[model samples]
Target: MKPGRPRMKNDEKQNLLSAGDNRHRRTEQEEDEELLSESTKTTNVCVRFDDSPSGLGKTLQTISLLGYMKHYRNIPGPHMVLVPKSTLYNWMNEFKRWVPSLRAVCLIGSREQRNALIRDVLLPGEWDVCVTSYEMLIIEKAVFKKFNWRYLVIDEAHRIKNEKSKLSEIVREFKTTNRLLLTGTPLQNNLHELWALLNFLLPDVFNSSEDFDSWFDTNNCLGDTKLVERLHTVLRPFLLRRIKADVEKSLLPKKEIKMYVGLSKMQREW
Candidate 1:
C-alpha cells in the first residue's frame, strides 16, 4: 500500500482556519468603511480636509482599510503609498496597527539599502503595500514604473499642485488604475493648481489644462453668480471633505481669557 501523507491535528487545522477568517473579515470603523466604499467605486478620489479632526488617524485608517479589502477580495496589489520622509514610519505603524495580516515594506535609507529591498522584497512582490517618500520616487521612477500598481495613494497631495515639478512629472508616469489624494488643504492657491490635481487624478477626464483654465476665466470675467455653484458641481462628485468640528463633537473651540496680575517684589528680584 502507498504511504499516506501526515495530517494536521484537529486543533491545528482549526487555528489556521480561524486566522484566515479573521484576515478576511472587515474590521474598519463605520465612517472609514463608508469612505472606503466610496473610494473603491471611483477611479479618482480627493480626500479634502480643512484640518484633521481625528489628528489624521482616520485618513490613515481608511487607507489601511482599502488595502486590506483589496487583499481579501483577491485583487493583485503592490499598492504604492507616497508620503513625506517624516511620515514614513507613521505610515508603517498605521498599517501594523490596522492590518497586520498584510505585509508592508518601507523603501528608504541610502541608495544601496533601497536597491537591496527592491531586489529582495519588491521585485518578488512579497509585500502587499510599498511605502516610500517622494524623493525616493523621483530617484527610483524606473523601478517603480515596472509594477502594475492597484492603487496609488498620495498623502499631503498638495505637493503635486505644480505640474512642472520633477516629483509631479515623475509620479504621473506610474501605472495605476485608481488614485487617491489625501490633503488637509486641497486648494492653497489658484484654480490652475486645482486643475493640476484633477488632471493627475483623472487624466482622461481633465485632459486639457487650457480648456479648464478658459472655462474658469470666462466665468470669472462675467461675474456670473453661477461661478461658485459651477465649481462646487465639478468638484462635488470626486471630493470628500470633512472638518474638525463636523467629525469630532467632543473637540470644543479654544477660548482665551486675558488676566493681568502685578509681579511681586520677590518675584522680580528672583
Candidate 2:
C-alpha cells in the first residue's frame, strides 16, 4: 500500500484505526488510507461498499483520519458529518473508538440544548468534528451555513438523491472545500439519481443533468461495449464500489432452495 501522508505521526496513524476486538481487517486498512489520500485530491468522492462485508465503522474511522490530516496540514475545519438520526450516536461512538483525540459533538437532543451547543461549542470551534442529522441540518441551516467548513461528510448520502429535496438543498448551501459521500446503496432506481450524486460532487464538470443524460443516451445507442467502458472511466476517479463476493473470499455465496408442499383439503376449503 502507498504510504500515508508523511505528516501523519505513527501514533496518529495507529489512533486513526481501531485496535483490540475492533481492529480493521487488512482490506479495511488499505481502503481507509487510500480514501484519506483520495479526499485530498478530489473535491467530491462517493464510497460504496456492500453492507455484508463492509462496515460503516471503518468508513467512520477513515473520516476521522481525514479530519486529523486536515488539522495537521493547518487547514480550517470543524468538519461536518451529517447522518441519519438513527446513526448519530453510532458515528459518535465510532469516533471515540477510532480517534478519541479528535473532539466530536453530536447536535442532537432538545432545541434549546442544540442551540446551546451551537452557541458555546460549535461557533467557537471547540470540536474537531460535528455530527448532526439531516433534520437538524435543515432546522439549523442558518447556523451551519455560516461556517467555512474544511470537509463535509454525508453518510447514507442517497438521502440527497432527489437534489431538490429540502435536505439536499440545505446541505448544498453549506460552504465546504471538500465533500465525501458514504452509502451502501449509491444508485437506487435511475440514472438521474446517479446524476444527482455526480452533480453534487463535481458541479463544474456535471453542470447540467440534461447534458449528462444526453451523453449516456448518445453513447448507449452507438454501443459496441464502449458505453459501459466510458461510464466506468468517468466514475473511476470519484467512485469506489466493492462487494463482499469480490473482496472477501471467506464469505460463502448465498444459496436458494425450493420445496413443494400440498395444502390440506380443509385449508383449501377455508
Candidate 3:
C-alpha cells in the first residue's frame, strides 16, 4: 500500500455514465474508431495511469468511452477493478464521487464479509464492478473465480517484482484478457523487473528467460533493438506509459541539483 492523503467524502455518487446511455450519442464511424482500441471495448473503462495528465484523466475518459460504446451496444456491466488496499479505498471514494451510475463493490473487508459478498451478494449475473486489493486475492481467489470479468486492473503492479513471489505468480494466473496496470515504477531497478512485468502483460511473447535475454539483452542495460521491435509487434497495443513531467511542467517546480565535495580540515590546511 502507498501513502495517501485522504479527501473529504460527500457520500454522493455521481452518475458518471449510463449503460445504453443515449444522452450524448456519437456516430457509427466514431464508435468504430474507438472500438479499434479493441481490448477495452467493454461497458467499463480500464487504464494505466502514469505521471502524465492523461494518466490522471483516465476516469473521465473511461466515462466518455463507456458512454459512447455502451450506448451503442445494450450492455449491463459487472465491470471490476482490482487495486491495492490503500488505492482500493481511494477508488471506491473516487468512483462513488465521479461515477454513481456504475456500481462498485469494495473487496478489502474481512474475509468472512468478502466471502459472504462473493457467495451470497455478488451475483456475477447482476452485480457491477468489484474493487479489490491484491493481498485480498489470495484470501478471495475462489470468490473472484465466480465471475467472467470484462476487465481487470492492477495498480502499482511493481509490487510483483519477483517472479517467484506468490503474489507475482498468482496475479498472472488470473483469466482476464483485458488487463491494465497503473504504476510510476512499472519496472524494478533492473531490466529483469521489466521482464517480469512483460511476462504478465503478454504471455509467451517473451517466452522464456533465455528468449528474454536473447530478445531483451538486459545484462548491459543497453536495449536490444530487436527486443524493442518484438515488443512493438506483440505487446505494443496493450501498454501505455506516461511518465511524470510529460505534461504540465508549469504546474510543478523545477530545480537544478549538483553534487558538491568538501575538503577535510587537514587537506584545507595543507
Q: Which candidate number maximizes lDDT?
A: 1
Count clashes in each candidate, considering only residues at least 3 apart in sequence or on different chains.
0, 0, 2
lDDT tens per residue, model 1, 1-270: 111112234654465366552211212343254357656755434444434335445456556556645654554366788999999998888788877766778999898998898887877666777889999998888888766566788999999999989998888876565678888774843788999999888876887999988877744835775876787789887787777676667887978999999999999999
TM-score, every prediction: 0.70, 0.70, 0.66
RMSD of 1: 14.9
lDDT ranking from best to worst?
Answer: 1, 2, 3
Q: For model 3, what is the alpha-carbon lDDT of residue 226?
A: 67
Candidate 3 lDDT by residue in tens digits, 223-267: 466656765565455566555565445566778899899999999
Could you tell me the lDDT of residue 3 within candidate 3?
A: 9
Estimate, for each residue in 121-237, the C-alpha lDDT of model 2 and write its tens digit: 876666677889988888888887666565788888899999899887777766555778888774733667888888787665777999778767643635546776787788888
Work out candidate 3's RMSD over C-alphas: 12.7
In model 3, where do residues sit more than 4 Å from their true spots? 1-76, 186-189, 221-236, 247-249, 263-270
The C-alpha lDDT values of all candidates are: 0.71, 0.69, 0.56
Please estimate how well model 2 matches the true structure, expressed as its whole-model Cα lDDT: 0.69
